[model samples]
Target chain A: MAEPILQVRGLSTYFFADEGVVRAVDGASFDLYPGRTLGIVGESGCGKSVTARSILRIVERPGRIVGGEILLRRHSGQVVDLVTLPSDGSAMRQIRGGEIGLVFQEPMSSLSAFHTVGVQLIEAIRLHSPLSKKAARARAIELLALVGIPRPAHRIDAYSFELSGGLRQRVMVALALAAEPHVLIADEPTTALDVTTQAQILELIARLQRERDLAVILITHDMGVIAEMADDVVVMYLGREVEKGPVDAIFHAPRHPYTQSLLRSIPSVLAEPRARLATISGSIPHPLARPAGCPFHPRCPDAMPGRCDADVPVEVSFADNHVTACHLYTEPVA
Target chain B: MTTPVLEVPVLEVRGLRKHFPIRQGLLGRVTGQIRAVDDVSFSIAHGETLSLVGESGCGKTTTSRCILRAIAPTSGKILFRDEHGDAIDVAGLDRKGLRPLRRRMQMIFQDPFSSLNPRMTIAEIIGEPLLVQGMRDTRERETRVADLLRLVRLPAAYLNRFPHAFSGGQRQRIGIARALALNPSLIVADEPVSALDVSVQAQIVNLMLDLQDQLGLTYLFVAHDLSVVKHVSHRVAVMYAGRIVETAPTKQLFTSPKHPYTEALLSAVPVPDPRRRAHRIVLEGDVADPSNPPPGCHFHPRCKYATEQCRTEVPALTEIEPGHAVSCLRAAELSLRGVASGS
Candidate 1:
């Protein structure tokens, strides 16, 4: 493995609430190398989005990163700890959009409804670069073209409401690239689009990631998207990493019970016509009232009686790059 | 798989059209009609799931609303036969006459939060249909509401809670329970599981399928999720520019799609396998505005194999197989070249 561009070690984020402190992200860790895409897959309330927000220090009020080390590789070849960096400091602000660009789930909501797509892109460019208004506008147009938006010269001036969902998302990608960031964090960018549009967007993202050598942290519930784009996969459940490995390894042989259950639950077109879909019976446990031992023990079909319900499982190694937190693959099993 | 338990089609729509008058200027005069849903026709068999799928603004929702009579259709024939086997014209029903028709068909809205009244408790929300239909006695209503909640997998104790207390999936379940309160035979679910997580989506789709099996209900399932629609639907209807481009059995539609639009849609779905790489038919260009749709085939502007004939003459839907129908000038000549080439 190459040297990682970003390293998240023992990351834990919590929300201070009236009822109790909610451990929204608990001891999650991953590494992102340059020019590679790492996908974080989970259900809605599994803290995947929260984990992404914590990386940028955009975890809103009531939510705070309790413990962790976020190491980022600087352009000068220096590794800086993002956690220890002062909040709202100049260096951190420079990294927020300048070094690490974020593309939110809904382009319509993230982009200003009132402003034209070009105006927003220009604004982002001006924030990161010392370009004049005209230069920034040209840069914005260039970024739009870079993201595969055809006829950017004409479509750039259109308002958000006027553009299609796919076009708007392309503009969001353009804005993300306006500052020439090394890393892009896309949170369910194609979830709001149709299948045809989604495929186009995914292909665009993959092509751009290669051309720019940009490291990407993609957060999505769609496994298909993860499979198509991600080189490495991280399965998050109830704010913790259940499995992390190469996408091929994880898909071919998921060691964790939670990961297996999730994969089985998905209805695949490749599967037999009459094959019954497997469903993990039970909603994701609320963050406030999470399970004691294994967060997935309550729903695990192959859970050990005392082992899965009595203690937390450590990360057991399957291969050089594969790791899983499941009692089924503990030291005793080996 | 066992033989399909085929039943007579309970609802048939012919040449359905819905046009919203576009108001212009300070005088508020109607300038032109926004042709949201134009000349779309399909039939729903008893206990069968018919999915209407297309991108946003393709008139799938408008078609559903027209069938529900929530918004009156501009012109069409909505022939529905009730449980008594009596044919009724749903489009001609007024507010007073529509009351009885409402008991025969119900609508499950997309957004659970907005569709449900915030002020009403779960019980009140679910029981509203019963109350509106003049179901007397508070005791009987409470029991029926409890049953509905249990049917939707919600605990009976949650009857007193409000919509804000439930998660998106739970809220959608509540919406389903409310739609089923009146024992309607036909349920028009407009993207019921679109807002849910992928994992939650399968659970809801399975639940709907199970409910259909138990109750023998017909569903007009409208959604953009091809995977979910292909899973839950018995027959699939592919819509483009407010018109159905193709209608076929679920398997046939996925494997042997006739229309270029249908072929493009199926090819776009990424197979969830890291080892296998599937070809994606990238549709370039935006969806045309329905108000001023293309002269002939609405999809010609973006179609890869579009010819001069497709640009001049509008193709009429014709049966290519026993039950499969497609609206394409070159249905006989076109071939889907990818994974969905043949059955």
Candidate 2:
């Protein structure tokens, strides 16, 4: 494999609320090669979105990236430390939407309802690419077409409200691809969409990745989408990486108890009707009251006596492609 | 199966329609009606679970609301029969006549937190509904409320606390208790578990199933989640553009969905398996506007196998197999997503 376009090491983000300090994203590490789709799958409070946002330095105030290295390789073969770069640096400016684009979950919230989608797309394009209005509009239509929006020419003038959820999402995708970024961060892109629309969007993203060699980071809780689009999977629990591996390995032989429990909890489409789905008992532990030792031990079915209850388990490599942070898997497997 | 709990259907709906007038004038002149629910028809057999599954804005909620008479239907009949075999056409009832029927048919909303009145204590919120129907006397109401709390698996001690004091799953349990306060024969739960965590969702779903068995209650479950719907529903209705495109027994629909829309929906659902690969029938576009649906088949625009016949004529729900009804011109030839074409 070629050198990774982006490398994140030991990234940690936290928020200080009135209650206490909430360790949102703690020590998340991953590498993103061009054209590879990496999936971050976790429940609501797992900090998957925060990790994505931290990469862009969009972590809002009260929340701060206390530690980590975000390294980016420029087109000119320039290696830059993204975290250390000045907020107002010219290079960082070029990279924000130019090199790393984002497609948010809610199009209505991200898109301006009052403005026509044509205007928003054109503006996004112009911000990154120094193009005239007519050229940008043309490019917007082309990009919209790339995302499988039909009748792009006339539909570009339609307001966000006038367009359907799938079309608006396509428009968002067009905006994200405006600069033809090296990496795209899509946070729950299909969670709000219906199943049919979700499938189309996922297929479209995969097709685009193959065609353009765009590094995509898909953050979602849906395991199905991960199986469809992800090359690698990263499972987070209580703001930490509980498991990481190839999609097949993670799905088939999940090492962490949390990952195993999560997989078991989902009602399979192919499962017999009479069989009850294996549900992980108890809710996601609150950020403030996150249990001592392994964050998942409270809900883990195979939690050992002292190992899983006292000390935080270090991420141990189980295979060439798989890594898990569970005490039970600490010993070498026969 | 199990002697068909109530023998008579708890709620029977036929060609229900709800059209919101699109007016544009000081005088509020009616220009055209937005057909939120065009022509929906279904029945909830006694102690049966019938789920209305659809995407957002497909009028599943509207159809459920109309059944509860929370919102009046513009046309068609909603025959709701009580346990004593007393039938009432809810559509024809005025406020005075409908008051008594409210006890027979209760609704459970989507968001448990918002569905519950935050100002009131859990005890008050659950007991108020029963109290409204003249079940006064604080002592008796408290006892009944405590029992209801226990029924949903929440401790009776937590009854004095406000809704905000509990977690999302607990709040939903409280919402369930409040809905069951009237001991309604039929309950319309609109996306009851969608807002919960996945694990929490499973527990709540199991709780609902257990409650059904214990109470011998009928549930009109409405949700977009097909897996949960399949797990809970005895019969399933697939709605598209404010109309039911398909209706069948749960097993039959999952095994051999006849309609293209139903097939597309089922295929779109991601199977949580790494070994099995699914060729999902991805629809080309989003759901069309309910206000102005397509001329003929509302789904034709997005449907892949839509022919000219599908474009010009609206298909009626016809029985293609035993207990299976589908609305599609080409139901005979189409291959469904998850299920085999023939059963």
Candidate 3:
């Protein structure tokens, strides 16, 4: 395997609210190799998005990274720990878009409504590189065209609101690629898109990854997407990663009960018509009231009586890089 | 479970059209019309689920809204069968005439978060329909609410709790309980589980199927997720640019679709199995704008097998097989690939 472009270890992000500290992303560890896509799959409130934000050091106020190490291999062949750098400092700012780009779920919310798509693109371009306005505008048009936006010259002048959902997302991709970053973090990029549109966007991302040899972190709640795009998979329940392995291993021989149940629960196109989908027992617990021991113990069908409810499970490794955090594979501690 | 009688449809719609006139200039003159629902027609038998599947702005929701008379259609007949087995023209009904019929048809909204009122208790939310129907006694309403809650598998003990206390899946169940309060024969669920998580969505889908079996209800399920649609629907109508391009039994639609758009849609859905990563037919352009669609077939602009005739002449939806319909000029010649069998 090639060298990993980014390595995240023991990442824990928490939101300090009046009620309690909400562990949005707790001890999520993963490695992102160049030219390979790592999919972070989980349901809503599972903290996949928070993990991505933590990596970029852009987690909003009242929410901060309590513990983590985001190690990024820079273009100069020097590895730097992103966590130690001040989030607003020049070094972190340079790494944000210059080294790693981000595409958010809601394009309309992420984009500036007042500015034209070209204006935003141009600003992003100039911020990373010392370019004149005309040069930046030209690069912006090129970026839009690269992302498969039709008639980039004309569409560039349109406001974000004027564009359709699919086109708006294309512009967002264009903006993400404005700085020509080596890594792309797409947070539920196609969740808001139609199926056909989603196919187009996914294809675009795949093509761009191949072209740039970019390491990609694709976060989504859809297992189908993870199966389709990811080279490796990380399944999170609540805030913690319950399983991580090669995509095929995770899908074909899932270890964690949460991952297995999630795969079985989603209705598949291949499944027989009207077949009853196997469902997980309960909904995700509230962030403040997260269950002790294993986060998925409450919903796990294979949960052991007192073991799964009393003590946290340790990571158990298997062949083919498959790792699962479940009491089923671990010995009971004295 | 009793088999749905195919002879008498619970609700039938014919040539439904909903056009929102685009006004422009100082005088607010009618310049153009967005044909949100254009000449759409389908029928749902008792205890059957017929899903309207499409992208956003494809008019699936508009069709459902028109069927419920929540929004008036510009033209066409919404024939809803009454308890007497008489097909009532809901489109032609006046306010007084529609009041009683409203109890026979109810709508479930997409977003559970906003569909429910935060101020109202679960009991009040579910019993609102009973109260409106002149169930004067609070005790009677309470009992009925408890029964409805049990039907959706929620505990009757949580009746006093507000919507804020429940999770999204629980809230959706509450919404379903409210929709079933009137004991409507037809339920128009507009993207009901699309807002829910995968695990929770399956639970709701199963609940809906179970409820359908138990109550002998007909569902006009509107959703964009083909997987969920396939799970719950007996038949499906594929919509594009305010029109149904194809309609078929769920199994047939998945195994052997006749329409190019349907084939593309089926192929585009990402299969959960990594081993089945087949080539997806990427549609070239965006969905056609309803206000100014193409000259003939709305999907022709992006279709891979589009011919000259497809671009020039409008193709009427024609039945290719029994219960399978397609609206393409070369429907006979085109052997479109559906999702591979054994998915």
Candidate 4:
């Protein structure tokens, strides 16, 4: 592939909690190309959300990005290191909503209940631009229409609560698309909606990608959503990326044990009734007790005895695009 | 069935309706009624798992609550078969009269954290039911709790631990053990695994299936996830508004659905395979309000196959095949699409 639009390298974020320093996101890396969706899949405490927040410098209190570079290839063919930008500086502020638009899973809470949807959306537009109130409102209505909310002109004035769950998510999408961003980061955008509504939101995202040639980083825990939306996939476990590969390679022939267990565990629509699913041996380890060597050593079926516990395993590329971090691959099966 | 089914069904419900009055103003007069569970009827066989699958406001939870008599249902018949092969109208029985029958039917709730008390130990929570039914021997109750712990694959050593000591999956197991303490023939699990992660959900689903095989327990599984439903259920009932739109064997219904609502729901689910980007049938609007549903069909406003007749007439649930039922006016002529069978 040509030069990626966005490159994330060795991104590490830690939270200085009272219990201990939580390595929420440690040494994560990935790339996103134009018009392709990069899916980051993980469970609740696995730090997929923190990785997204790291890109925008929005990691909350007590959480800080200690190291790594977020390289973005600007439209002018110049590279910009997002890590160096101040957290609340004007340049970083423009990059937050202007260059990279982000949407969350729960639109009801992300959106303010006291304000009208129109006001919130226009506020986002007027923040970075010199447009008048009327012009910003018109742009906001145009965005609502773009996201497939019917009668955008009329619905724009309605408060967030007045809309249904699907409509609220659509309005959230409209707010994300307020500025013509080159990359969209949607973190579990459809998890809160019903299945039918999820399908619509997914289709809308795919269509927008086609129309705008945008690079997308789609984050979710559901394998089915990843398969449907992503062109490349990152399987994360315990704040580290266990595998990253082409979508077909990850789904059709996964190299990591965690990835394989995840697919096997899902009660796929393709599964037979009463069919038993294979489960990982233990739940994810508590963050305070981050395991030594390999994070998945406790639950891995193919873990090597002394080798897996000795040192951290670095990624090894098996194919052109597929890479996995496992000790069994390095040490021959005993 | 032609064999007359030697044993009575574990549970059966008929025309269950629960309407909550919307009161307002100083007089607190009833302005309108929210038909939470409108006319609904179905039966669960001796060892079958029948899943009630629908969106949130489609009355699945209300139906479960009505069956358990948590809140007295406005009207209906909850026919529960007793150990003596006698059918008892659970809905009609008074609290004093229903005490004995309550031991034969139990409910497994959806939220594991809130379902179990934090102060209570695992032994107390699981053994509370046996004690409530007049078991005075503490030694026997403790032994039974150990057996229940083994049944759910949890360590018996966890007996003295508080609910907070367990993980989400382990908490759900404790809830299941509590539900099974009295050996009820019927268990109503309302989204038992919806709150869990994907891997943990499989563990609980497998445990439920194993328990059913070992104990011959019948389950009325309530969930909105069709994919999970297809895995554990023998039959699937699709609900819309407050009524069941379709009921059929899980395989038949998933592969060749007769109801348009079911068809759309099946299409809406994302196929895990990247090879099959399913063409989804996205309904155009939100679910209709239960308080003031449309004149005829509640779904006509968003249904793709709605006709002039559908707008003026309500369709009754009719049997199209041996065990397949649908409530659609165009069921006879509409050749709807279904997912191709087999992985």
Candidate 5:
């Protein structure tokens, strides 16, 4: 395998609140190879988004990266630890959009309604390159065209509010790719889109990844999406990675009970009509009062009373790349 | 699945149309009509779930709202069967006349968070419907609320707790219990589980299925998620630009769709299995604007199988197979692909 462009090891991001600290991204680890897509799959509050924010050094106020190393290998082959740098510092700012671009879920909220799409695109373009306003505007049009926005020249002048959801998302993709970043982090990029629109967006992302050889971190709650787009899958539960493996291995031979139950529980168009879906027993626990040991123990059908509740299980390797953090797979301590 | 004996449909909608006037200028002059629900028709048999599947602004929500009388239809009939087995045209009913029928057909909203009142306890929320129906006795309401809670598989002890105390799934259960409070024969669920997590979604879907089996409830399920629609529906109607393009049994819709739009929709749904990553039919453009849709077939602009005739002439929905209807001009000739059946 080619060398990983970005390696995240034992990443831990916490949110300090009045009540208590939230372990939003607790000890997550993954490798992102150029031209390969890594999917972070999890339900809401599972820390998938926080992990992305942590990597970008954009964890909002009240939140901080407490531990872990985000190792990024630059074009010169010099590796830098992203966590050690000040989030607002020049170097971090340069790397934020210069090397790694982000696409958020809600384009409406993330985008400035006051400005036209061209302004935002040109600003992003000029930040990463030494281009004048006219040249940057030209580059912005090219970016929009690259992301498949019809009549990019005319559409560039329209405000974000004037664009449809699909078109706005296309603009977001255009902005993200404006910097020619090596890695793209799209957090729930298509969740807000309709099915047909989602298909189009997914196809666009896949095509862009192929064209640019981009290392992509696609975060979503939809397993269907992971199956369709991800080369590797990381399944999270309550901020912790419960399972990680090749997409085929993770889908066909899942190790973690949560992953298994999740795959079974999702209503599939391919499934037998009117068949009752197998359900995971309980809902996700509140972030403040996260359970001890395994977070998913309360809902997991295969949970061991003492092992899964008293002590956290370490990741157990089952195959070349297949691994699961569960008491079911871990050896019992004497 | 054993087929139920044929009976008079619990709800029948014929040529339903809902058009909102697009007023322009300072005088607020009526310029044109945005046909939100245009000439929609379907029937939901007793204990059957009929889903209206479409994208946002495709008029699925408008159709459901029109059926529930939450919004008045511009024209056509909404025939709802009463407990006495007489089909009452709810669309023609005056506000007073529709009052009794309202209790017989209730609506379940999409967002459980906002659908529920935060200040009210579960008991109060569930008992609100019973109270409106003239259940004056507090003790009786409490007992009925308790029963409703149990019916949705929630603990009776949580009756005193407010909506904030529950999860999205639990709040949805509460919403379902409230909708069931009146013992309505027909339920219009508008994207009920779409707001929930995948795991929580299954539990709610199963609960709804179990409730339908137990209570013989008829469901007019409106949602955009094709997978959930496939799982829950007995029959499905595919809508585009305020009109239904196709209607078929759930199995037929999934295995062998006749309409190009339905085929694209079924193919668009991402299959969970990575091994089955097939080439998807990416629709070229956005859904047609309801106010200014294309002259003939609304879907012709994006449909791959569109021909010259499809662009110039309107196609009326015609039945090619029994229990399966499609509106495309080349419905008979087009061998559109569908998702292969079985998990």
Candidate 6:
């Protein structure tokens, strides 16, 4: 297997609020291999999105990546720490979209209504490559067709508002792939779409990933989406990694109590009809009033009294390529 | 899979259609009609939850509203049964006549944050329904409100606090409590738990089920999530383009679906387990517009099995087995896939 394309080590992002410092991401680490999808799964306020934003040095106001090394291997095999790069420097700007493409849930958030879809695609293409307007327009149409939008030449000239939700998402995918980025970061790309449309989007991503050989970082709260799309999974709670494992192990043999309960809590479509769902004991705690020690100790079903609350658990490998930070799994399971 | 099946239905909707008129010109002349909820029909037995599952703009909410008369439907009959086995034509009733029947049918809205009045305390909000139903004594209303708070598993001490004091799940509980205050025989919950987080969503869904068992309440559960519907509803009705394409017992529908659209929708859902990822039958193209739907089957535009006959001939909802109904030209011939083995 090829080496990892991007590496994150000891990444920490904090939001300096008036009340106190909010540790949105605390000492999180992960590696993204080429052509593989790494899913970051968590509920709201879990810092999954913040971690993605931090990699691109695009954390919003009041929130900044305090410490970390975000290493990315370029096409030339040269490694650079993205965290140390200046926010608006030429290097950061090139890596932000030229090397790493971003796809958000809502296309309108990234695409403007004023310009035509073709115009936006051309802008992205021209920014990365030294292509003329006509050449860029041709590339834009080709990208549109690549993303499976029918009659691309005509639809590309149409405004974004004129397109449907599914069509708009396809356009977003076209725009993201316009630069032929090495890595793709999709944050809930299909959450707002219908089931049929969602299937289309997922298939498109998988197809494009193979065609482009892109490493994908998928951030979503839905475990179902994670299981279907991810090769590796990272489970987060209250801004800390609870478990990191292969997709199969994380789904079938989760080590962390929190992950176990979450799998049980969600009502699976394949389950028997009218079956009672197991529920987590409590809601996600207030962000500012996060639980001490293991962060999920208060809600963990199999939490140990003093051990879970005293301090965070050290990482332990429960199986091949599967590690979890839970007090219950101190030693590797045979 | 055997459970208690009620004899009489608490709510029955027949041939219901809600058409919004598209006006043009200065005088607002009607140009065309958007058949939002066209020829929809379903029944929820007493103490049973029947979910109206569909994508957005498929008339799930519109059908629920027609039952509540929130908006006047263009045509159809809404028969709501009371405790005395009387089936009242809710659609044909005048304002004065409908006012009394409103006590028997209460609606739980999707948004908890906007549904409750911020100015009112928890006691006032839940008790307001009792007052509307003609519970005169102030002390009696207070007693009922406290009972409701306890019934919904909320603390009675929270009665004095405003809605802004609570979280999304807590606010939804308040909405449920208010819907239950009138002793309504049928509750119309439109996406009741969609606004809450996943963990909180499970809590609300389980609470709703528990309440159904305790109070013997019938629910017209409308939602887009089929997984949650399978957990909550006894029967599921799949709607698309404002039509009931399939209606069957939850188990029968999930295990062996008859409609191609049903198969596509079930397969599209991302199975939580990676080992169980089945080959999805993705329906191509956007959902048909209600204003100008396809000639015959609304889903013909996207169905892979569509032929010349399917494009021109609309299939009627036919019952193929006990408590199972489907609408498709190839319902009998096509053996569609379902998530039966949890795969």
- Native contacts present in each candidate (fraction): 0.44, 0.44, 0.76, 0.62, 0.89, 0.76
lDDT tens digits, residues B252-278, model 6?
Answer: 888899998998999999989898776
lDDT of 5 by residue, B220-332 (tens): 99999999988898999999999999999999988999999998988889989899997899999898999999989999999888889989899999999999999989988
Better structure of 5 and 6 per lDDT: 5
B129, model 1: CA deviation in Å? 2.4
Output the number of the lDDT-best candidate: 5
Off by over 4 Å in 6: A331-334, B2-4, B25-27, B341-343
The candidate 4 chain B region of ten consecutive residues with least summed lDDT is B1-10
- Native-structure RMSD, model 2: 2.2
**Clashing residue pairs in candidate 5, if any?**
none
Off by over 4 Å in 1: A271-275, A332-334, B1-8, B118-121, B153-165, B337-343
Complex DockQ, candidate 3 = 0.72
Clashing pairs in 4: none
lDDT of each: 0.86, 0.86, 0.91, 0.88, 0.92, 0.90
Candidates 3 and 6 compared: the better one by DockQ is 3
Instruction: Highest DockQ: give the candidate number.
Output: 5
Instruction: After superposing candidate 5 on the true structure, give the runs of residues whose Cα lies further than 4 Å from its correct spot.
Output: A332-334
Worst 10 residues of 1 chain A by lDDT: A268-277
B240-294, model 1: which lDDT tens digit per residue? 9899999988888877789998888877877777886676788887787898889
lDDT of 2 by residue, A74-175 (tens): 777787888897666787788888999899999888999889999998988998889999999999899888889889898998999988888888888888
For the second chain, the TM-scores of the candidates in order are 0.94, 0.94, 0.97, 0.97, 0.98, 0.97
| TM-scores of the models, in the order given | 0.95, 0.96, 0.98, 0.97, 0.98, 0.97
* Clash pairs for candidate 2: none
The deviation in Å at residue A275 for candidate 2 is 4.7
DockQ of 1: 0.47
lDDT, candidate 6, at B116 = 96
What are the per-residue Cα lDDT tens digits for candidate 4 across B1-343? 1111335688889999999999999999999999989999999988889999988789999999888888888898999998988899999989998889888889888899899999999999999999999888999999999999999999988999999888888999999999999999789999999888887888999899889888887899999998889778888999988999999988888888998888888998888778887778977878878888887877899898999999989999999998799999999999998777666
